[model samples]
Target chain A: MKYYNWGIIGLGEIATSFTNSFQQENSQITAVASRTLSKAVAFANEHDIPKAYGSFEALLADQAIDIVYIAVPNRQHIEHILKALAAGKHVLCEKAITMNSAELTQAMTLAEEKGLILAEAMTIFNMPLYQELRSQIDSNRFGKLKMIQAPFGSYKEPDPSNRFFNPDLAGGALLDIGTYAVSFARWFFTSQPKVIASVMQPFSTGVDEQSATILQNDVQEMATVSLSFQAKMPKQGVVAFEDAYIVINEYPRADEAKIFFNDGTVETIVSGDSTQALNYEITNMIKMIEGETSNRSLFLTKDVIDLLDQMQQNWTN
Target chain B: MKYYNWGIIGLGEIATSFTNSFQQENSQITAVASRTLSKAVAFANEHDIPKAYGSFEALLADQAIDIVYIAVPNRQHIEHILKALAAGKHVLCEKAITMNSAELTQAMTLAEEKGLILAEAMTIFNMPLYQELRSQIDSNRFGKLKMIQAPFGSYKEPDPSNRFFNPDLAGGALLDIGTYAVSFARWFFTSQPKVIASVMQPFSTGVDEQSATILQNDVQEMATVSLSFQAKMPKQGVVAFEDAYIVINEYPRADEAKIFFNDGTVETIVSGDSTQALNYEITNMIKMIEGETSNRSLFLTKDVIDLLDQMQQNWTN
Candidate 1:
């Protein structure tokens, strides 16, 4: 099997978590970059990464890195992903993919021109548990799918300096956690629902502290999602059907899930967390580079980016 | 002081709770009515009400009853309130005062013509706790209000037969619990905020099981609210100001609440709950009839009903 060397941008909490998960999965972290040299050096030392570079440019210039995972803030994802695509490296970008879909399309054009694989790191999509749930629904085990309800939120002190609460950082609950819930709804429902109405609370720093979104598709299929940074919430997803229901515990963040049927039958699907979804995308990119596939089919990273952009524009307008 | 003898329409859970509370507050439940004479007789006998009627029309036609509390389902609120208003009795309707706001307006106009008080039973507005919190915010104790977040949800089995999951009954989170959260936001902000965005999940019966809403005023003040019948949630409200936050426990429902300040100070405010907020309106109606006031102001029933109408239209559109 061919191995893909990875370069990571942005040495933040998520970056560290991805690095640790990648290492545990036996994936190579070939290079690491940060805005500051000292921080990069410290992260490299802690993670046993082969190379640490102070500048993104230097890391992009390196020929050994086969894939670059853009783990930076929302605004930076576009620039960094474009640069990585320009440098002939497959790119795995974080969620919200870009500040908007237009930026995402620009990056996609560049990636397409270079014959490079570009995917968004939406971890839940690649999990075996979700796949199994999808299969069950497709098989009509839960009868006709009716609704999906999910809430992903936490009670955290408001800190304007943090990227999660900084408007300039493209921060808000919708772009952060809401993406997961919305994506799950779209993925399960297999259609983009119209944003029917919304209510949001802006923090002191002008970022959404909590948001409630309601969407409905042409078939009248509806999904309700709540994302918050101001309260404690159950990190779960519920799929309600005509005959039965599927409950995903810690969905969008859980590797394993339980399925409940209308007949009082319960089945637990355990998909070991073998890799942080970022690393899985890296593996997929390696497969694509080795002539297996050309683009992402399940997530359609570009389409998701477009959908997010549309949602944000709708909210702002 | 002049006292108003009260008649209750629909002797269900809410009506029983209201009459029980009213009795404790020195209010008289002189008449009770339901579609079934047995139900009304049973309720009246249990509560020591002097009169039990088989139908709502009979109760409304009674000249001795000065006020009527319409505690029927959402679809029936308008009909019952209008009937009571047409009978020249003051009416205190339950939340989501009508199936939509148009019905509320018609009832309000009829009440005005009859010179009768037509108010909504939004007991939270009458609670001393909310009043105290409002006073603190008005006094600039928490600085300028920036955000408001509240999530109110409960987990229940999805049985199409249940009123909460039955579309024919106008069942949905938005019309039920969501209205409370929306009303709380409007009450706090005291302005009509645009519904920026919304997402919802419809139950098998075609009613919304869960809904998330975001609203923003022209000044950019925002509030996010989530309502669900699919999960358990903290029935509380959080008001984030420029310098501090006031956290209210079990807001929009409970009489007593704990307020948490940003500076780590905590205080508790307790208010009368004998009538589940129904007695407060009853007391106010008596005062109004006695020339103490010409109309209800504490709850601003008109504004709330209007807001609900606008929000429901926004969702449908």
Candidate 2:
């Protein structure tokens, strides 16, 4: 059994969570890096990692690191990803992979040319509960699907200095919580929506604070998604069919789902390792590193990027 | 105490329910009319109404009627309302009162000219719980209002001959369940929205089967509404604020409301006569007829119709 060595770029909060997921696995955080040497050393001590570097490029240069996980600011992902790929490292970047599809396409082309796997760390696709729901939907278990409603939001005070309200960092609801709902809709449909309509309101700091979107396919299947930095929600996704409907709460790391039938009874299905949801993605990343790609089936990073781009265009126009 | 007599223009299912709401009131259904004499006679006999007319004209001509409750098809509302005003009777019409704002303007103008009350029987505005919510919102009980999400939908098999799928009757999800959500948004904002974005998917019968809309006002207050004829929903409305939020289930006839604050304690408020939700509308209609205009506050019948029209236009474009 081959162990996968990992290097993390940008010692952010998400990077710590991703490193923690490797505790019981065939992967280890071999190296970590930050903009300053002291912070990188502190993070390395915190995680008990082998190496610490003062910059992302120094971390990428470590030949023992098979994959580099980028958890930097949203607008900087593409640049860091390209640098990691150039240093012959497989990359697993955080969600909202890049600013737009054009940049994503360029990064994907680089990864393809280098024969390296590039994936977005969207844990929902690795969730067992979401997988089961998709399988049931594909097998006509819920009958004719009609509509889907997904909402993800949180109330954040609009501070001008916070990254969430900073326009220079590409901070907005669509790039944060909105991406999950958009990806869920695309996965459920398994096809690009024919129509995308959206409206966005700006925060006081000039970033898109809240957005609502509607996606419809040729068969009249509809999906409604609402995301905001102005409210906190229960974080549920509802998929409706002719005879029954399914509601999945905490959809991003969904562990349980309920099916409400027209007959007035509800069937609940519980799955997914909630405490270790990130482990699934880590394991899949290892599998891809070993040339076994089956676990990467529903990796819709590019499609989600495209959909968000379309929705933003719709909102702006 | 003088009793008010009602003349129903269309003896359909809604008319039956409206008449049922008068069980404990200062009003009585004196006459009923339908396009066919047998149906009108059967409905009148079934409801214990005194007089049955074969045509709407006959019901409108009855001088014994103090008001004409027009529960006819959407396309016929304006015509019947005008005729009722001409016959000197107060008009209480079912929602989606007219095809467009122009028609509604003509009807309201005629009612004002004749000194008659022309009200749309939108039950949400009359429900005590909804009124309480508006008052709380007005007084900033929930803090600075951020976003509102309201959804109403039900699975209805598309029978082309059914009124729900018929274009001649001006039928669609927008005119049916969407109207309530639109009215709710309008009533909450108290100001017209600056942007209305929407998407609609048509049924096989060429009427809009599902619609999702986002309405945003000048202060960045946003409202999202979804309606469908092909899905079942929980029929809930969420009003989000800076420090707290409230969820209203069965919002049109809401009897229970839950307020969740940031301090992790939830406060639930239960009010309104659920069993007689429709009676509130009847009671208010009676008050409007008896010169008490306070109950008519937030009578945004024209505004809601205009918003729906704008949303439909946005969906088409």
Give candidate 2 regions above 4 Å deviation: A295-299, A315-317, B295-299, B315-317
lDDT: worst 10-residue window of model 2 chain B:
B290-299
Model 1, B187-291: lDDT tens digits are: 678466766666566678878777666676776566767676765555667666555555566777666656555455777767666235666666666766667
Candidate 2, B62: how far from true, in Å? 2.7
Error of 1 at A316 (Å): 7.0
Q: Considering just chain B, what TM-score does every model have? A: 0.91, 0.95
Q: Tens digits of per-residue lDDT for model 2 on A1-317?
A: 58788898988888878877776457788999999999999999988998999988888878899988899998999999999999999998888889999999999899889998898888787777878888888888777877888888788877877888888878888898888888877777756674466878888877788887778877777888888887786677888887788888888887898998877889999987777887777877877778776534324777788888988887668
Task: Output per-candidate TM-scores for chain A, rounded to 2 decimals.
Answer: 0.90, 0.95
Q: For each of the candidates, give the backbone clash count.
A: 28, 0
Listed in order, each prediction's TM-score against the native is 0.71, 0.94
Model 2, span B64-121: residue lDDT tens = 9998888988898888888899899988888878888889899888888998888888
Specify the highest-TM-score model's number: 2
